[model samples]
Target: MAARLTRWAIFSVAVSLIPLIFSFIYLTTVGPTPAFFDLISDGELLLISVALTGAAIGEVIDKKTARIKSRLASGGGCFLVASLSSSYFVVVSAQDDVRKEIVMGMSCALLLLGVISAGLAMAASEGEEGG
Candidate 1:
């Protein structure tokens, strides 16, 4: 179950990055429109992903640092950074209502997957130690 969850989480993270990458590409090509700055100046779209990344690092990592735990935590951290940075363009380019909601939805979905991944990784690490 843990392995399954990890795979799902990884897949979810990968899926989540797709829109962000496209957003970056779109912004590079078209430049930021006026509507972009009007909606997301404070970066509210990324709040949950950032918070989840922090919780994963602060709550999961410990003195022992089991291999699975460390890897997943680090991977999540990396994804968090990539997601946030990429999302900047996403929010900037999302001039339309549909695009805005899609980006926000993906961000929240990534956050959910990150939390589940952290929990499952910890569980798997404990299983590793015991059996």
Candidate 2:
């Protein structure tokens, strides 16, 4: 049970991060945009990483992934916070409109990722105690 839960938590991370990573790559390097490396490895990614860590903690801490997931099953603003911040940067910093959308979209995806992250953490924590 614990192992299954851990698998799910990791699966969640992989599942969520895939869009983020891909969109991030696509958005920042679709055209004659600035440096792709620069955009992808900037503050936005850093924020996502940190926030995801927190979210992961939240999920596993409760000793039951299902429990945390249940609480956040039908929630809002999953990626709104991250998207807003990322959008701001994308609009202001990204000159190309296409790239901007990609960046913004990536942020939005990451926002969702952040939301699920907490649940993952809670689930992991629950599994730790053999719950």
Candidate 3:
């Protein structure tokens, strides 16, 4: 189950890149369209966010102390970065200041959660190893 989850996570990450690559190709051939590019970038980032989240969840489910610690740390970190990037794009594209602020706040909260999860996973792993 763990291996399968890891494979799926990897596949999700790879698929997420497809939109950005296609968007680049479309831009090169058809010239620039900010709206279209923004749409594609946003979708790509969201996909990446989901992928990282899946990876982190998978690591937690696996529950192998040492492995879980490293995987959770890396996966959570990646998720946090992706969430921040998504929030930035959301802010840039959103017209309403109120909505933009709300989204940004939520994104920051998610990042904090990711950091906390990573730290806890590490501590749990250490406890398992030492006790």
Candidate 4:
């Protein structure tokens, strides 16, 4: 169960990071994606992913190095930076469309996933607690 939860947390993190590159490609080539989608692909989602990763690492600190937590957090932050980069063109290209809202919505969804994943990871890390 712990391993399963850890996998799930990592999966969520991966899913959140995907928007950074995928959304950019979709928006650039497909001509104006939704804001909700854009948001899902941004730093906010990545931040949440990072926070969750930190928590997961914290849970496992007894078996691993403490530095891994900070490192993974930085990795999430890097994803955030990548996601934010898409904003440069997205803002100027789609002004009056529903792009912003959709992107923001997506970002929130990714964030939600990240938070939930973090909780699960933290919970799973408790060696004595066998869920």
Candidate 5:
């Protein structure tokens, strides 16, 4: 689970950061634009990705002590928080309509992932109790 989550976190980090980096560079080189504002506003997602990746790293390094179900539950909760933040960005950021729609879709995807992770944690807990 730790490995899997770490992979997921890494992928998400790439997804969030790659565009951010390119956009930031473009903003710096080209001048002020809506993309720059979008980058500034959407920056929190990078932090969230880093934090979740850190949590996964901790689990991987401390495998002997970390509880799998708890880790999954917490990871799921973090995802929910991130999803909420993204949703807020969609509503608050004055980004273009197309980008706003993209953010909305990302929020929904995050919400789905959170629910799935939470469900997996619950299933794991049940298995532990039953056996």
Candidate 6:
């Protein structure tokens, strides 16, 4: 399980970096534009959310000590918190006023999903310890 988790983490990190690399290349080739930058930012945020969720899932599957599990849960919680803030900022910074409400609504839904994933990870960890 631990090995599988490690592999997953590595894969996720690699996948997350692809957009960043592309964004850098795009910025260097074609002058920066607000819309383009915003699109890249949104893509990055979505990738980050996926990576964090992957980490949480990995931690839950890993057969680690209770202390490690607790730490992993806390770390996942922190990531979710950061993601929530970033999502809110994305919605605020969006240029389309009409879509702002929709973006905010989606952000709230993602936040709820993050919270649920974290809760599940923690619960799974606890269950492993027969607690």
Pick by lDDT: which candidate is best? Answer: 6
- Our model 5 lands, by Cα RMSD against the true structure, at 9.9
Candidate 3: residue pairs that collide: none
Worst 10 residues of 6 by lDDT: 34-43
Which stretches of model 5 miss by more than 4 angstroms?
32-38, 42-83, 94-131
Off by over 4 Å in 2: 5-10, 32-36, 64-130
The TM-score between candidate 3 and the true structure equals 0.37
Report, for every candidate in turn, its global Cα lDDT versus the true structure: 0.52, 0.51, 0.50, 0.52, 0.49, 0.55
lDDT of 5 at 84: 61
Model 3 error, position 86 (Å): 11
lDDT-best of 4 and 5? 4
How does residue 66 of candidate 2 score in lDDT? Answer: 44
- Please write out the lDDT profile of model 1 over residues 1-131, one tens digit for every residue: 46645664566445545655666667767875435433333344355355445544543454244576465756566456546645654664565444555665565555566565555544433434442
**Which ranges in model 3 have alpha carbons more than 4 Å from their true place?**
1-15, 33-43, 66-131
Q: Assess every candidate by TM-score.
A: 0.39, 0.36, 0.37, 0.36, 0.36, 0.38
lDDT of 2 by residue, 1-131 (tens): 56655675577556646755677667667756445444554336535544555454444344343455543542223334444555655554555434544655665556556555444444434533445
For model 5, what is the error of residue 98's alpha carbon versus the real structure, in angstroms, after optimal superposition? Answer: 20
Answer with 3 or 6, whichever has the higher lDDT: 6
Instruction: State which candidate, 1 or 3, has the greater TM-score.
Output: 1
Predict model 1's lDDT versus the native. Answer: 0.52
Model 4 lDDT per residue over 1-131, tens place? 66766676567556656756676677778776555544453335545545555555445554333345554554454345334433533553456554555556655655565466555445434444442
- The local lDDT score (0 to 100) that residue 67 gets in candidate 4 is 48
Q: Write the per-residue lDDT of candidate 3 for residues 1-131, one digit (tens) a residue.
A: 34443454356545656766787778767876545434343233443454455455555556655665565665566556556656655664564444544544554455455444433433333325432
